[model samples]
Target chain A: GAGVSQSPRYKVAKRGQDVALRCDPISGHVSLFWYQQALGQGPEFLTYFQNEAQLDKSGLPSDRFFAERPEGSVSTLKIQRTQQEDSAVYLCASKLKAPGQGRNEQYFGPGTRLTVT
Target chain B: AQSVSQHNHHVILSEAASLELGCNYSYGGTVNLFWYVQYPGQHLQLLLKYFSGDPLVKGIKGFEAEFIKSKFSFNLRKPSVQWSDTAEYFCAVIRRHSGGGADGLTFGKGTHLIIQP
Candidate 1:
């Protein structure tokens, strides 16, 4: 794919239901990121991955929110017992890693809009 | 923790109007700054970024941003805006030395720009 891709463009789940969002990052992208964007707000970091390593999960809101990139190519963000407050757009981004470089430009996906009813 | 602030929640202007959007960060150390634009029903797209050197950085769509270390600000500007430029703008930053473990961005509450014809 030329850009990051996310599945289930829109999801509506009843409160307490579990929902899973998927993200497929650009091929060979070494860094993947997840973010949550509430209505009228900017996207907030949720977690980060360097290949298959879950190097950072501090941004996950709670224990119920989990993310994994097992094979380093695709990632999934699962929310258990979804609450109304969980209704927001989930964004996925990826970046190529440059040796010795501290940063690189990130490419973003269309995002999946989740609505907890 | 680093935090970003975008002062304008909403801005309205007519076509060909000069445009400026303010963004400030609270980080004290070296940081990378970025501006992203999200059009209606479209994915987020990078407008520009500031990594090092020249304080002024140019991006796609004739947009540019200036990084002022003294003010901890990276403000976006354009000489003239068209109706097609109406979109939500976000400012983001990442600590330079955070390494691969903490590569996610901290974003500000977005500014909504409306350019009327």
Candidate 2:
């Protein structure tokens, strides 16, 4: 793909429902990141992956949020028991290589706008 | 935890006017800074980044940012503005030696810039 691609550009879910958002990073990107952006706010880091390993999950808001980038190509962010507070835009981004080689311009996807009622 | 702050929540400018956006970060050690813009109905795109070397960094669309170590600031500027420059701008920073484990970025609340033609 030319850029990062996210599935279900918009999702409407009822409270307590479980929703999954998928992200397909650029073909050869080695670093993948997930972020949550609320209305009128900047994207906040959610989780990070280096290849197939989940190196950082400290930013995940709660137990309901889980992200996996198994196999190092595609990633999925799953939210269980979605609440109204969970409504936000979920963004996925990728970088060409590891974190700090002095090259860290992450390319972002259009993002998935999730609405929990 | 490193954090970013963007002071101006909204800015309005006319075409040909100069533009400036302020961004500050909180971190004791070396850090990587970046500016990203999100045009209406589009994904976020990197504007510029400062990892090392010169403090002045130029980016696409005639945008540039200067990193000031003492001020802990990386402010974006454009000598002239256009209607197309209207967008939401974000500032991000990552701890320099946090290892790949904390590779994810900490972003500011964002600033909305409106350029009228």
Clashes of each: 0, 0
Q: Could you give candidate 1's per-residue lDDT for residues A9-117 as a string of tens digits?
A: 9999999999999999999999899999999999998988889998788889999999999999899999999999999999999989832356579899999999998
lDDT (Cα, tens digit) per residue for candidate 1, span B1-117: 789999999999999999999999998877789999999999999999998999999999999999999999999999999999999999999733355424788999999999999
Candidate 1 runs further than 4 Å off: A98-103, B95-101
Per-residue lDDT of candidate 2, residues A1-117 (tens digit): 799999999999999999999999998889999999999998988988999998888889999999998899999999999999999999999988988655757899999999998
RMSD of 2: 1.5
TM-score of chain A of each: 0.95, 0.98
RMSD of each: 1.8, 1.5
Candidate 2: which stretches are off by over 4 Å? B95-101
DockQ of each: 0.71, 0.86
- Residue B41 lDDT in candidate 2: 98
Predicted structure with the largest lDDT when compared to the true one? 1
- What is the DockQ of the complex in model 1? 0.71
